[model samples]
Target: MKHTIIFLFVFVFLQKGGLLAQSDGDNFLNNSVKTEHFELLQEFLSIPNDANYPEQITENINWLSDKFNELEFNTAILETEALPLFFAEKLINENLPTVLFYMHFDGQPVDLSKWDQESPYNPVVKMKKGEGWEKVENPDFKNLKEDWRIFARSASDDKGPIAMFLSALQVLQSQGMSPKFNIKVILDSMEEKGSPVLAPAVADHKSVLASDYLVVFDGPMHDSGLPTLLYGVRGITRLRLEVFGPSKPQHSGHFGNYAPNPVFRTAELLASMKDENGKVIIPGFYDGIEIDENAKKIMEAVPDDERGIRKRAGFAKPEQVGGNYQESIQYPSLSVLGIQSGWVGKETRTIVPDKVIVEMDIRTVPETNSNRLIELVRNHIEGQGFTVLD
Candidate 1:
């Protein structure tokens, strides 16, 4: 995935006159990816990027600063409450439009026991063999295969794109070429943790971060392995609901019927939020969202393999939220991410749990207000004859 994206970036740059002619650009791209690009990715993937470790994040920032500096980019460390973000800019011409690119360096926590390799930070090359991947001890970069993969945290999530961007710049520099637009980059250091500090930091550095257009180099490529461009993404908000029962757990045999089970209450409240067809039943949840004829035509033009999606996701029928897969995402959705009431499996208990906790998330579109949706959910809870508390 990393190499493929790097090729795409360089190819686009060539078309945009940021590199030599197509013939020369093709040779340069191949050589750079096999050599410089591969080396950069390996070095980057070696860094442990779990945001929980501030020291590790600092190390990544240092490395990033050095790389950008080497490319003659003006770099700065944008300080935030938790951790600092890495910023770099290259102004080709003040009169030209500026394009801001967003990528992340932070990765999720790793479990050593779960990984097949020595460490998740150590990237490994593998090739598909039967039903599993077989490690390639020493990959021959000169003869890399299409199916070969480099496995590492953040390799694709973000760091891969960063390396690709840098590689493209290096190629342009070698060819004495420049882009048509000025460039600004903001790399997040805490993206895996929901980027709690990103909004405030952006507000604080609004002038420096200002740009004519913003391009986020994140998210998966289209399933068809074609170049994809997304115009909009769904905004997210979270909610936690707790149903309280008795102060302490009681033996199920002693008060199974007498003591109120918060689990049942939670179930009832959750059930009211959605119908069997999986559409949110809350009043005004779907308000202000409308798909016109043109939007429908644009959505239907997407070659989404509905049957393939259903088979891969292991579902017989999809929710009737929209006419098809593309139409479904246009509306807001309420999803229950997790629920915990009592122990199960080997930890099963013969007592009624004291409380039930449900964690949910709401994906909103442009027409909806996140705070308003949250209020509607809270009101619905209260309407269910339950006392709601923040």
Candidate 2:
């Protein structure tokens, strides 16, 4: 799938100038997306890129600088309060419009015990075999198949695209072809951490990062396994709710009927925000968001396999927030990312926890404001008789 996307990307660039006939371009691109591209991806995936570690981010930035410089791009390290960002550019002509491409090298933390592979950084090529997958040892890149899968952290989420972008540029350079627009690339080192420093860094380097257009090269390919271009995406805001009860943990046996359990209060508060249908029940949470008939028609036109989605996600029923998958995301969504109270499993204890902490995130559409939605949630909690602390 990665190779297919890369081939299409190169093909589009070649097609712009009518450089090669369809068949010729196909053959050339097939050869271009060969061992070299795979090797680049493998090398990149081998490096641990958890943004929590500044050292790891530095290694990735160094690697990126070297690769971009080798391709005749001038690269710089843009410093931020947290980790620094990487910027590279190739000026074709001063008159040409500058296109800034955004991609991230940082990935989420990995738990080794949860992964089936030896290591998340150690990428492996595998082919599906019935219900399981078998590793393809020393895969013949020349005969790589579209169905062959690469298992690794950040393989698809981001690193794959970065490798593809570089490979595309390499192919163009090999063919003595240059892009019509001046190219600028920005690689984020802390994207996995919600890009806390990205805004300030962009503001600090506004002049240097200025471009006629910005293209974000993140996210998965369409579920249809076809090329997709998204015009806009929902914004995100997070909330942490801490429900308090007794000042200290109390033995359930002693305070069974005396003390209140923070867990129960937390659950009740959360339940009030959403009903059985999975729609936010809080007043004004979805205010100002309305999908007209024209917009609904456009969303319905998407080729979404509702049943396939349910089967893949292992859910029998989906939230009734929207009529279909497309309509659902068009409205703001309130989701509980994680919740914690007392220990369970092997660490279970018969005690009432002092507090219950719930982490949630709200996905906001254009019509909604993140701050307003957050305030709405706070108000909703207060309406349930829970004091919301700053």
Candidate 3:
């Protein structure tokens, strides 16, 4: 699987951090193990692991517990406020450093109407032929094709990686190989639904979950189709700026220009927040983020096809942020997720909206504090001659 390649880089990187044992991923992922891994993935995909349903989540936990138990990992169902977290650890020696692996067993709920297949859980192995996927008959297990995809819910989003990790353990077990460091695996039960119980659980079980490093094993895919090492992920902060106008919706035809539209006020406020080159104009938004020469060299090392990316995205020019795509994300980003002033489409309204609501999600980097960025936004809005209510 493509995700396996991504984990290769992750494993190698974690090895440096003493998270994983010193073993090349290439040597571990043999042909037979990969075949078995695919088989195991099919079984895992068979379980309907939508966290929305308690019963399904129970099944997923049981399956994971059984697998971990089989692998000789001491299994424990760690209790939490919500669904209990599944924990398994193998302590090789007391002196060795502990490396905790963070993984999510729960997947997003699937709508039957969206899939062409009989069921989302029932996976299909298909290969692209003339731009259309054609199911293979008696697929070659000896040599799995990299281009071939296993169509299933959470196949790549997360579950595939879990299967891959389990397969790696199986290979290691078969060869009587043991890691030097103490290994711990924490499987989150409610990660898909924003991990509501995680913080409380972590706080409560600090000693048990404590480790030298936390290795997260989740993501869709890297565009490069190569194992890319990401230094960090941008944290999120939400802001809903409500523009106040008349208490009730006024008749546009009657009031016309006389009635001040909250929509216009909101639009102008949003427009002032960003420049024409897609940079946030709010003071202190990009403060403290000073990319140095070393950062520039690291950014330049990423082999990105800038022209190809532009062609695929159907754009002519790139944003004038930090030279390239990899560099641009290094700075905090401001994105307007959604904005609503009045009803549209079939429910079109012909009146000036009473108030306008704009939702914005700011992607914060380690260089910037979320509170400072929010304060800057509030100050910027106030400077635009508008009263911000919280």
Candidate 4:
């Protein structure tokens, strides 16, 4: 009996020690919710940092800089030839690999009518049911489930992830689980504006951003509730292609047959770009787009229930072709995002606009390049007997 008890004690001791060792790796946060920390988040959410409001945006950047400084990080404000960029570093060793973490601080403009509370910035806490949210008076975090979410401008879209990452890091520091790689946190102010200046900024700061890997915490997960690890994103190229006929607007009534209606010509040009099944009708559009084994495997993992997807997107039918969510996103597409010419409003109706401006964008897949796609588009337009002007 004595020997059996001793053996049981030894087994228990080793089992418990093994559990602790495994848990030491996940030391970022204790699974406890501290409401006080949320107070600081709410306070930060109240500050306006609309990119259009440059002065207020600067103030917000300074506040974020102060936050890094408070966290004992070596913080610096870097410029990207456009808006200011904040780069904060916390290095444990000089020789360690670096992980560049990216996120944006700016948010979309506020629409007061859509807000639930009085103001989007004056966050209010209210309760009526089981789940809770912060009624962000600022209205940054839209699509909120409750008053616990602030709707100011960029709440969940980005600022929420930014806060979560930083807070997690802070907790990790508190727990003494040092980062394996050198850390670089970059906060951009113009991501919502199509990140026009970001690519150039990254190229210029290649040395400063030299890192083993980059972790971009943007966009959301799949509606199927699966934890996603995106390898790459589809690149976009936007251009305004115009077909000029005459010098100025002509009265369609005066020269119905003789004058070239640019609107009709524009319609014909766009119609030839895509088929009825929504596939890009351009020749060679699908060239070099062979689905690799890995991509096929990843896509096969996606759920294929029409009911579930419809319930999530709040629609009965899929948005694009190829029958599933994965195909719609994976394949390349050419879409005329916007088209404007002449007057369709209340005041104007008689004139045939001479110049038709069609703004189109093409989303490219991995095997394709944006420049080559642009070349294809320009070629297609010119081939259809239309004058091409960049």
Candidate 5:
């Protein structure tokens, strides 16, 4: 019996020693992995990711596949009518809950003439020096600084976060540990263009995308520098209104008083939609919103610094739509985004324009009925003695 107890004690001691050794080994590996950044972000940024160009988007897909594959993730290129979605998942444990992470890979198309750099795809690292940035042609651990920014398309907009996430996977791999939960990532390729195929893709790949929770990692930081959790986002819709005038372009001198300038008519129509203080004049447009006492208190408490904002914007006074900027957005707004009349600037012309086009975008909240808002705008326009065209 004494011999049997000795054997059991030896086995237990060895088991405990093994666990401690593994823990120490993992800590050492993790500490050393600080230098491993998964994949060089410069290479990812070097690939043009404009979803409008399929060739550019395809190259990004291949790169995403290779990087995720290195981490032993099951990668799939989910097809859609537009650009394909890059989906990667690592099922570490069947019993663990699944998490779906959403990020976009596409970037806004670059206008080379407008960009200061040779190519938008070629990222430049720079450090801030006073009001301007000093170029850092090449960066290494010795020279890299925290304040240095990467000037490239999609660098901060998304690819930066993606690079960080990939590095996190590498850190876990180095430590010989799996993710606490099953991980799935969906990298959208057409997010800049409003993600047209996203809804259809969701419907078609419902089973593939099933998860306990979804986390979207693309958005701006809170103004207060505090982390924020968003419950919902406002929906957007646009309307283009074109008002025809003369059959053809007429000389402004010849028809200055005789011709009814469509530009002026269009201007009047737009002006009628809103009051002088910038409130939407269309009846019932803001009916759904209720500014309760609690909401007023919250709005009043926020330190928005309206005077500072006005100073930066070079405005002595602001439109009295709301008490402050934060409260203003709570109500639906009508804005004439752009008004096109005759050519100006270097292309100045003395002729009246054939037609005037006004572009508008509406932000919808949960309380607002989109159909009712549309009807109200339509009724207001008709009430102003204007023709309604489909």
Candidate 6:
């Protein structure tokens, strides 16, 4: 009797429109989902091509074009010096405002050995909460696992999002929800490399790329999956320093005191750049960097935990930023990535080297130009009596 009741309840639940129901508020973005569409995503992720694999990259682009054609959308491959970009569009309500969805087809280089599945390019299926499966990896829920998570090079960092978008469109079509707005999808191949070629591509294709607004679907979601919307992103600048003194290496025992080791001099020069408390000694660095009131308000809105963040990050206490994690995320920071000079291995290490190279990167916020920052750093080094060598 209990089994009969359970079966009846399940039947009634499935009868109430089942999994294919679309209400008035149902829109293409959230209302529809298709299993075949998602399987296509798995297939798409199976293509393995990094910046090095030109032939495979072309094949993947062509495959994407065929998929767009199957969806009855116009597709084109925009070519650049590097890999080709795939652009697909379906023009609905010809005069309505168009929103271009930005995505990248290329993925980060991956370590094959560390991959859980056979190949990162072999796309797999992992479901979250039932229905049809999604691509996100889950250690807890392992119900309907398939060899579908594309174990390829560019799987999650980007290709996952692209697949999700297409899968959503496929679902909408299945639910008889043809798009209402002018929809476009841009899949770039060079985004992983700081988008060195995007500016030119955007310029050359400005007419076609013109839109009411641009939506970038990248970066990780906040720890809380509350649908974060960002207005801007920070800029970055890198400085490379090379110090040269003596022409060649000399035995430390013979010329240790006489020869000026470039490594030591480089250390002294770097010391002159910053203080123990993390205040940059460079002049005019903070000249135009007055944080705006809006930025301050945004920073304040972020939650703060005086001690909790430190504990979570395995730190003892607060840092030089004089605040919590939220505030630190809002402020600018300087860090030394690496410094290299002479011997590194188990080789006998009693020689003074002639040259030393220090590489550092700075993350900059708004109103800062890369060229100006470079000039300021160069001037600061020149003021320290060291000849600024290229």
Give the alpha carbon lDDT tens digit for every residue of 1-390 in model 6: 111222232232223354333434444333233345446656787777576677777877888888778777899887776677888888867777687989888776667878666677776544344543456554222222332333455555687667666655554565565544677888888676666677788888888788877888777544333345677666667678888867988889988989998988888888887777666667765455665677777776765554655664677845554234554544445557789888877975888898988888766777566677778888988888888867
Residue 324, candidate 5: Cα error in Å is 4.2
Model 5 quality (TM-score): 0.80
Provide the global lDDT of candidate 5 against the true structure: 0.75
Candidate 4 per-residue lDDT, tens place, 299-344, comes to 7677756677677568765545454667677777887867878888
Writing each residue's lDDT as its tens digit, candidate 5 over 1-390 gives 111222232222224334112333523432332323412667888999988899998999999999999999999999998888999999978888898999998999888887667788888777888867777765663334656777889887888768767765665566565555788999999988878899899899999999998988787544453445566666766677888889788998998787778999888998888887888878888887888888888878876677767875789887877777777878777766777877889999888778998888777888897777878888888898888887
lDDT for model 3: 0.80
Better of 2 and 3 by TM-score: 2
**Cα-based lDDT at residue 306, candidate 6:** 48
Residue 292's lDDT in candidate 4: 70
| Candidate 4 worst ten-residue window by lDDT | 1-10
Between 3 and 6, whose lDDT is larger?
3
Q: What TM-scores do the predictions have?
A: 0.90, 0.96, 0.81, 0.77, 0.80, 0.72
Worst window of 10 by summed lDDT in candidate 5: 1-10
lDDT of all predictions, in order shown?
0.88, 0.88, 0.80, 0.69, 0.75, 0.66
Q: Candidate 6: where is the Cα deviation over 4 Å?
A: 1-42, 110-155, 245-279, 292-297, 303-319, 329-359
> What is candidate 3's lDDT per residue for 363-382, written digit by digit as tens?
89998899888898889988
Tens-digit per-residue lDDT, 223-287, candidate 1: 67788889888888988888999899989999899899999988888999999999999999999
lDDT of 3 at 185: 91
C-alpha lDDT of residue 351 in model 5: 86
Candidate 1 Cα deviation (angstroms), residue 327: 1.5
Lowest-sum lDDT 10-residue window in model 2: 17-26
> Candidate 3 vs candidate 6: which has greater TM-score?
3
